[model samples]
Target chain A: MKYSGWNILKQALTGKKEWAPVWHKPEPKSHYETIVIGGGGHGLATAYYLTTEYGMKNIAVLEKSHLGSGNVGRNTTIIRSNYLLPGNEPFYELSMKLWENLEQTLNYNAMVSQRGVVNLFHSDAQRDSFVRRGNAMCIAGADAVLLDERGIRNLCPFLDYENSRFPIKGGLLQPRGGTVRHDAVAWGYARGSDSLGVDIIENCEVTGFIIKEGRCVGVETARGNISANKIAVCVAGSSGRLMGKAGIRLPIESHVLQAFVSEGLKPILPNVITFGAGHFYISQSDKGGLVFGGDIDGYNTYAQRGNLPIVEDVCAAGVAIMPMIGRSRLLRMWGGLVDMSMDGSPFIDKTRIEGLYFNGGWCYGGFKATPASGFCYAHLLAKDEPHPVAAEFRLDRFKRGHMIDEKGAGAQPNLH
Target chain B: MIINHPLLGPRDASEFIYLGDASLIDRPDWNSENAAQQFYEYLYLRDNPAGTIRELWFHEYGDRSWLVVTRNTLTHEIVNVELARDIDREEKHSR
Candidate 1:
């Protein structure tokens, strides 16, 4: 049990460039019961379900690079279920529930911290909206508490309370919302699925779909064509192209999100704090480094490099909120590709193509939803039916006018 | 709405696009949830204390980036928006 989810998280959260390839050779068996593309959280989780839940052992997870090299390996790791839409709400809630029991679910340590999250509100209008969202989460069985000025002051005492910019009117607090080790979530699933005998192929990129008679039979990878009964596409950052290859268009936009860490400091704050008016969120890592992240890149590109203007803006907000951190210097900053959808929520559903399934379009909440996404996706992959939580994320939503838009923003990458 | 270059400090009033009534200025606690709340109170409340100079102008409605100048009764005309950088600037006010 020591290899429990949290322990593995201890290693992954440090962001060490370690971790070597474990199992599986490059030999494609020409056929598998299920073939999952993209070895990130969603793909690995889908593979895990195909094996453990359905007892369907003929499965394989194909990654272009080594495992966890995608967004799964590069995220801010904030886990929360404060959604406003029905399609996204239940799934995120389920993901939050999964995070609660991740140690038992994966039998690995993921450093799941229930430090609580506070989404602040600036204006009365904002307050009302925040309250509505909080109430919905409360009804959905999440521990959400609505806070006012006094309430916010009690939680975060070191803020610049006098003549400030975005006044600390109040925040919506979900005690269950916290963070975890992102990389470990990937390795834990990879290990869990590996132990279950799923073939996880790394450094093997999918070249094209083996579409036979309008049905996907397998994928033609760089090594060669590997046939399979069912195929899953889970390439997050670069998923749009892969989906396009299958003759289907997904409402996914690829954008870059940047994250930074301040030099390690003693843990002064216990909960994760975010600025409502300005786009900024800060959390202290176990390494004592202050982890910070903000808004998506205004443009679309597969490039991993981030712009510096946003860095300056977010840093200014940080200083305005917590002047005490004026002495804190940003040690390093990195960017990751985001598969932002029309709505800010994620989508994981089967496509119109026969023998083909998809598990992509997780905007920013991929880390916390790893296990639950895997569990439900596993269920979806095994039974050929959408999990109860993932039923509404169909690709036809846009055409049908049934979009699950939590932010009321369309799938434009710049808006998100 | 138009806001001055030098961030208008709490209650320290200048020419601002007519949004609403005079807003009050309240002190912010070191630890508060939305940090932007302190300045926003200025929109609804004004702390126009009499016979004193407050060296502050606010860009509450940050719609456009413009180079505007501001002056106070107690002090001479100052603050050139030509170089309205986003950096935090400090000016000592003699009340």
Candidate 2:
């Protein structure tokens, strides 16, 4: 059903009984041309693009649990393309462009707010790096603005600009970067894909791959064995175990990254502000809650809950930049499993095995890269070639010594 | 998470530095024919299991010792902690 202002008024004038469900829940068929594992935003968006762009009708997106139960619903929802690396800046800028018209394309209100993002720099060296990143972003066709101390203060006056330690000197602002309602992305993509004859099978966990004669033929799921010509895996944090089952060990580690939301208060934060002195970024939701997050827990684990040490550390960083955040009441916190890649980037490429593709290792940037990750992944699966923007994200890049070390951190999953 | 140190009774996990899977301690022999591939696997690949796992943790703040910690990843329960130096010496002796 095409939803618009006219549809709402018509449904209101009638009894509202003619309105249909967003997407139909259907049983899985015996086989499909392509099978996508995991029903998160990326997986659903992959299926959506495969059908919409490539015109592949027979596709299925299998989810272990309910849709949007993974990182899609657990992120702080900030989106940006402010990157310095050639491999990263273009890909993220593609995602940012897709996000601009996502709600209109999906015909669902994703609540994409372009309130802008500011990465505050505390030192001259940090400012230099931000300048380099801003230049790279502009080269990649994304907008960037270098804001001095006064410019930053004009935007956010409540910051601790004169702190003795970690003083805020300036900032790099991307006017296009902002937040989106994370779960709505999943729903919109799911509904759009389902409308195009794509099967979105929820609660269907894939147990193992059917690799016959060294080529993936199908998958063994909780429901039944379903065959497919092509199988694309985009299960985020579960990438390690799933690919390991297929006899492939990825250069990825599963770590829990926590996110927090403070109790709802009147609007205080003007926009998303990131602390360059520390690993903390915060933004105020439309509902008036301050949503924020920091570094991942420095361990390899699949746990969805974090300890108090990280909570205390994140809150301390919050207080360092904006001292007023200490007055806000702590509401709740949660963790999502992130597939931390070796060089802090993502992969969207085919494996050595024919007809078997993989898409993961997004680390902390999966939520923001949802649309382009899916689109580029679809392009790869359809054309069997990497997208121009995502060409550097090959699994063999590490073996070939072409690692896109965006942070310049050498082969450290936790540091990335 | 409270990791019980072998020397000190109990220490908070915050005092320790997480070094990932304990399999890292069993470093592959450098003189082997597939030394390059083995080292690559040892450094990059991980088991990343969901249940009980043996891991390496350095007590950076308290005892200044690198300890092997056996814990459940899902439940975050510490099962055992032993001095990593002792384990290294034992591996050397067995070799």
Best by lDDT: 2
* TM of each candidate vs. truth: 0.76, 0.98
**Cα distance off (Å), candidate 2, residue A131:** 0.7
Question: Lowest summed lDDT over 10 consecutive residues: which window, candidate 2 chain A?
Answer: A17-26
- What TM-scores does chain A show, candidate by candidate in order? 0.92, 0.99
Candidate 2, residues A361-405, lDDT tens digits: the string is 999999999999999999998999999999999998876778898
| Lowest lDDT block of 10, candidate 1 chain A | A16-25
True contacts kept of each: 0.00, 0.67
DockQ per candidate, 2 decimals = 0.01, 0.72
Name the TM-score of candidate 2.
0.98
Best by TM-score: 2
